[model samples]
Target: MKFTHTIKAAALVGIAGTVALMSGCAMSQSGDLNGMKGGGHEYLLTVTRPNQLHVIDTETNKIVRSCDVPGTFGQGTVEPSPDGRIAYVGTNKWEDVVGFDITNCDIVFSAKQSYDNVTVKSFVSLAVSRDGKELYTVQNPTRKLNDRYEVMEPQLAVYDTSAGLNAKPIRTFPVDRQITKIMAMDTGEVILAGNDVQAINPENGDIRILTLLQNWKRGDSWTQPDAFAMHTLGEQADEFILPYFTIKWNGDPGDMEKAEFWWGMSRVDLKTGEVEQGEILPFEFIVFNFITDPTDSNILYGAFNTLSKHDIREKKTLAVHNMEHTYYDLNMTQNRTIYVGGTSSDISIHDPDTLEKIGSIKLPGDQSTSAMRIAFLK
Candidate 1:
């Protein structure tokens, strides 16, 4: 079985004048979408400002379905089920999580991380186990009792996906503050990325620090690493690739170059909890997110105001291309074609070898913002 573009749905969500005619087929069992092979529907799921989710067909470059997600405040990240059938998003002002059945364009699961009495916020990244049995996210919570509010410790919240909508966190384990990303490893362990990476046992909630960023030794004045890309790369399915930048402040206010900062990535091994890094370089530009070519780990691609391809071996940017607008997410095709989106209405596609803009897909609507991350389903 291989990934294909087959739109087989047992159910379909009908929105008046929106989401055009989709076949009214019986919905497939909510299972591992990554397992389904042959011709199946492949989509680029994007979430916009004020809680709107647009599902665009990657092949057709058209909006096949769009839905206004209720209760979602700021734009959050979208994580797809293993089968790619459902997209789970952390919304409702990053205080709630919802699972939307992309085929039907309806929510199938919802969990609120925060409430009036208990305020909680998930930092926009969610992880689903490869088995699709558990969902994990770092929850920052606060409890309000009487007139005073208690800031509770952040915890790793786990939900059983099979529990369906309204699935409450079955278990929560204490996690460190400033945790930016959560990833379910191939070994039934969850990786929490922040100041340092940690591997946690899903069954017993035991956590161990996998690696430290300071080991790279760029400088002592480095800031916390912001790992925006949580998904594992294809080449290193058992590893997590985190691209982050560190800022430094020098006494010379006029010397901007001295304070230019540095950027690099930490390639973490999920099973053994090991980490490795390449050369570190100055922050030439702003990169909100980045991805490495699984086929060629030496080549790293970054996205923001410009799309850049840096050769880790060479320790310099191989090429840079101006984008129509800044991007928040970056991914590549099987053959290495690049897909950059998240900031404006469309996704920009570029050649992997040359970093040349070959094509672009303009999404439906005016001023639509792509979700924090884009899911490319085969």
Candidate 2:
């Protein structure tokens, strides 16, 4: 009984009364529940640079603990609160919020809100709400005349981490673009996708813009091509696929070889945008995120520097698994066995029901950072 959230800036009439009490409620379709028996395994809450939040224990995977996220957090990622005790970290530094402590990982809480002062940065999407108390972040409002895509700011902020340690007040939801994937739907609503993928109601963020495709190709000049990841398998009126990742950028210099660096994956029907017939997931290092198998929502697993798998109803890519060093976020728990963290800090363990590789754990750093997001502290 400790979630004391109170962040406010919201009032679309309480998001239309919580979307009319979650309109019909039946959205529970995210299960394959592999239920592993491996004891206290799966971990890696990392950051390297001058950034910090390390705790890797992927079944003896390594690096027990390292904390101190005072706030410089960027390109956001870190989640907990399904009774895993407490860990809801989302920051862009200025609108800071970080809290941790599930059996002594420390970082109890640190929130700072109130700043519509304008010009803000840092945020690439973060979610945690299904009932783990409350903590959702999505920021995208930059004006550096940028669109080279470094991913940050699309605007969305909601915090109520049980309102503990004086929690609350950072309520916002402003969008026009740049929310790379945010899902906190447990009949509560807030399943935003980006480049343009919407579903909002963080108690009153009330957004509903889902249009599967119109510009997603992803990859070029090095990457920033487009289409990263978005998941919402089913429920709330059934029928949900909505996957993403695409890239395209026509060049013009008389002959830039017609410019096109191919990469694809598509599935959308968010109640009639009807775009089916897309599949393409291969990587040479540039696919930063992908994970779906909250049981078996058609089984999808990606890490785009390589560490892949997707079967979204046989749409394509059943396995891509090529790692001795290459992974940076991959999760599936409720017992479906699969936890992979990367940047060569190494945290691998698979078998998300037959994507089988079985084991790996070696994180304490030797080099390489960013792209390590995992949670499971039962």
Candidate 3:
């Protein structure tokens, strides 16, 4: 049964109750699950400018399909399904999590974050379990009533992936505000990283503060860490890396020479709950984003006016490669092909080992990428 979902704002209460019930139980549908097993090879999906998702052929560097996501556009992250057949896109304007089918270039699922007077947007961070049973997200909300807007509390929401299209969250638990990112660990604890890192038990909404940067003396006179890169070491790797940068107050904030910027990285061992964070770079220009080399944790690559290859142990850049423009999203494919995209309509490919320019894939329609992911389609 197809649901058009056109309802009056006055009926929100009734719809909320209905959604709660449906969230627990998903009515099974008869459709093609064969594709769920995967057949296609490597493909790239980029959330582009002005509300678009461009699917590219990684081998040929050609756009095979451009998926249209109406009414949304922003710099956010994309989470690929375990099977790599679908892509979950995070967008604030639409206030919904859209799952796009890369094979067919269609929207297979959409979970709306808001209805009626209530509006909620997930903070770029979206996660699907390795078993593919659950979807985890942190939602910041706003409510409108009597023609006035009121900021609401943020919450951690979990959805049953099997729960068909447009499924509401099965459960939502109140969490502290200003959480920017969340990653579900194999231990069933969701790591919420914002001002601080926390390990939260999603089942009961119990939060345990793992560390306080201020107390630990991680940095003196620094800025907030940006936890945007969602790269992992497949299902076999044990360590997780978090990258960010901070500005230090030298003298006057306006004096560039007096003030210094530093790049930092945190390496976390999931099983042991051990975290080691240190300043990786003494000076930073414009390292907008970075990703740790899954194969070698000592190495990391970041994008900006120049591509920087850093030695995590030495806390310095091993090599630097200039770019045409600054990029935001950076990732390495399973085959070890590095891609940098975000600031332009094209994705620049490079050899991860040599840092040499491999080639470039110009996307169709001249759209700039906000978030791009390298997916292996079985």
Report the lDDT tens digits of candidate 2 across residue range 312-335. Answer: 565566666676666655555545
Q: Give each model a TM-score.
A: 0.79, 0.29, 0.79
The worst-scoring run of ten residues by lDDT in candidate 2 lies at: 24-33
- Tens digit per residue, CA lDDT, model 1, 308-366: 88878777888888887777777765456677876676778889888889888776543
Q: Name the best candidate (by lDDT).
A: 3
Ranking by TM-score: 3, 1, 2
- If both were scored by TM-score, which would come out higher, candidate 2 or candidate 3? 3
Q: Superposing all C-alpha atoms, what RMSD in Å does each candidate have to the true structure?
A: 8.7, 19.1, 6.0
**Residue 41 lDDT, candidate 1, scale 0-100:** 47
lDDT of each: 0.68, 0.52, 0.68
- Alpha-carbon shift of residue 280 in model 3 (angstroms): 1.7
- Model 3, 1-378: lDDT tens digits are 124343555378557645643532322123343333235466777876667787777777777777787556745467777667677887656377877766655555668888888888776667776555788888888898897889998888988876555678888888877676566676778777766677788778899876554334635455555544443322222445566666776775556677777777666666666777877887657776667776886888888788879887887888889998777667676566788887777889999888888999886543443666666675
Between prediction 2 and prediction 3, which has the larger lDDT?
Answer: 3
lDDT of 3 at 106: 57
| Deviation in Å, model 3, residue 351 alpha carbon | 1.3
Residue 253, model 3: Cα distance from true site in angstroms: 12
